[model samples]
Target: MILTAIVQTKAGTLVVDLPRDRIDLEMKIRSVGIERLSDQIHIIDDEEKSDISVKLFGESDIGRHLSLLFNENYTLFDVNKTMQFVANSVEDIRDDLEMNIIHDQYDTPAELVGDIERMTDEVGQYTETFYFPLVGNMEDDDDGEQYEVGNRYLRYYEYEIRELLQKEQDLDGTNMKDYFYDDDNAQKKMVSCQWDVVDRNNTLYGKVEFRLREPFTAEEKELVRSWCIGQAADGLGEGLEQRPIETEDGDLYVSMWNSGDDYFMYDEDEMNDYLAQQQGGVMTQ
Candidate 1:
């Protein structure tokens, strides 16, 4: 299984891929070495948060669970500094932890909270540019295989999707990662936004998709969708700070649905089909 570890530090946030057993996992993570190790492992499972980031410790996205080995607790923040990043106030967080533990919220207790500063040497939340990977059996396109996400996309817009992949060849890029960012942004604005070209009803459209990390509620999804639509066009997410987005951009409308989604399932074919049905005076199916 592919183990995705999202390591957040004082420098920058990183999304790493580590696939191995407990022993190997330990050696790989602690290759840099630390002063000491805790008596046990701990985890923060925040299924109730408004975002995809739950664990203050690294997020381990694997099919199953294993004992996590984290070290270097004595050097960093003391009780005061560490509690600053917890749920609410330090007092409230203590109560919350106690209640959550009694309610079976935390998967494992790990070492006691006396050991502050888990995982990496530095720790803090980066509100900007949150990184989370699309997990599960998503196969590479080269093998001509489609998993749950791709198969759903293929059901309706496979024809248009096939054409897009072919166009990707002449496009200059060493790999797919090149096209997965908004180049206009000075800093690397990736994972948050990505776009591609598609042919729909003979008109070229930008197939744009947005990501809403997790605890995906209806409001959060719409907020991200609207924001991406505003940016879908040529640097004008609102459609004209530099360019008009949505209708003006190749895409008719901006949209997003990840987290509890199969990547995204909408495509040009579905749009055309809806338009056709509307034109026929039949309600868009």
Candidate 2:
């Protein structure tokens, strides 16, 4: 049940295949220094997608940080745990366990020395300062680290993201970016900043869709869009997809207080069926 893939090492000479089953979970946890057992845990899963991840919920006895991602959440655990609550007595299952454990360690000063390389663990920066232009990460900075800096509003991209944070407050892109980029507490009217807008997940592959209050040139429109999303994400702390979706009624707008999902869908048949159902529903109505 391991995620099948070839992983290249830091040295180009070494190419290692991912391990599905190497050791037992007990041994795995022990390897990561989970000795005292006061480790708090939180799990995020999408049952439909067969995805599950167990992460450190709070400070652990082992001062380090850890999280586990399984290819098939139920299958891996089911094979290992079988019917046990504790899952300590698992055998061949452990040797065949398919998952990845990311182990981050700290130095005497508590700054991360580095992530101890485990099976398929990706090396990471000790701390990351990310700007949320459209979505403020709701996930806790339980690593005792503030990886992402936020502003005020957050939405998945409801027009309200614009109406509420922009129209209501009169804050524009220049001000919004300045406010977010500044990690200081000072009396300030407006700060200057660059136009750095990222899609959800803080990546370049993000789509933002909307109409503006007054018409503007292309450059002006770009700044307005960035400000609109930045303001919404800084304020709301959460948001949905900002990509343009056209409907018979009009451009769909939502509130920051809601949630939705956008799959990287490749199921053409399924999508067609869904669209057909929606069309039927509309016609029926």
Candidate 3:
């Protein structure tokens, strides 16, 4: 049986033919540049000039095994150096075939596998560094009204999302902004809430809830409540919703307005109920 394959290189393609009968079980198969191709496959002091050698056993399975080994070795050969080697080897092979002679390029299967694996690992690392911090917090300063609180909130949320992605083992180098802003599938899977704080007459008031995206189910609402409590605890030194009273299957909401010296937490339910009672007509339930 004769096994034939084509080796492609920058210069051109060279054909390889292996005779099953003459295959050696232990001898190494090495290639040396023919005289005419010596200029293309440069030799460094003539000692290191030949193409790599591969080993083969006389069996049907050996051809399959050898093909895999050849691919791996060629991929790892310092791609630039390997290209030159392949160009020269192909030239030599073509010359030999024209002269009715045979030639083989040899490489070990293990070496090829190792090179390919290393290249893959390097590429993966590069991708991770490029996409790790999509949205980062801005620095704060005393010269102006720095959005310190808002920046911290964004940082915390980003960290939480990163943790979730890590848990799912999906931390590929993908831009978070693209996923959140551009992709519809991502929009369906992820949720974001924005809080706008307004300063009126030296008093601060804010509203917290989902923006653009809405219909926050009970679970999502509770999650927002917990996140709000966390933010308040970190920024204001206390959890504002610790003893939230249940109203209409939701926690009793509180709105705070704080001046330089006076801070008041409004009982949102009490204010609404008082208004309802004053209007009468069964208080609108």
RMSD of each: 18.1, 22.6, 23.8
Task: Give lDDT per model, in order.
Answer: 0.31, 0.27, 0.30
Descending-TM-score candidate ranking: 1, 3, 2
Which regions of candidate 3 deviate over 4 angstroms?
A: 1-191, 199-203, 212-214, 236-285
Question: In candidate 3, how many Å is residue 36 off?
Answer: 58
Q: Considering every candidate listed, which one attains the maximal TM-score? A: 1
Model 3: which ten-residue window has the lowest total lDDT? Answer: 126-135
lDDT per residue as tens, model 2, 188-241? 211121222333322321222221122344454344435545544433333233
Alpha-carbon error at 169 in model 3, in Å? 27
Q: Compute the lDDT of residue 109 as modeled in candidate 3.
A: 34
lDDT of 3 by residue, 45-125 (tens): 122333422222223433444443333223222222222222222222334322321122235533433343233333232
Q: Is candidate 1 or candidate 2 better by lDDT?
A: 1
Q: Of 1 and 3, which scores higher on lDDT?
A: 1
- Judge candidate 3 at residue 62 and give its lDDT: 33
Global Cα lDDT for candidate 1: 0.31
State TM-scores per candidate: 0.22, 0.16, 0.20
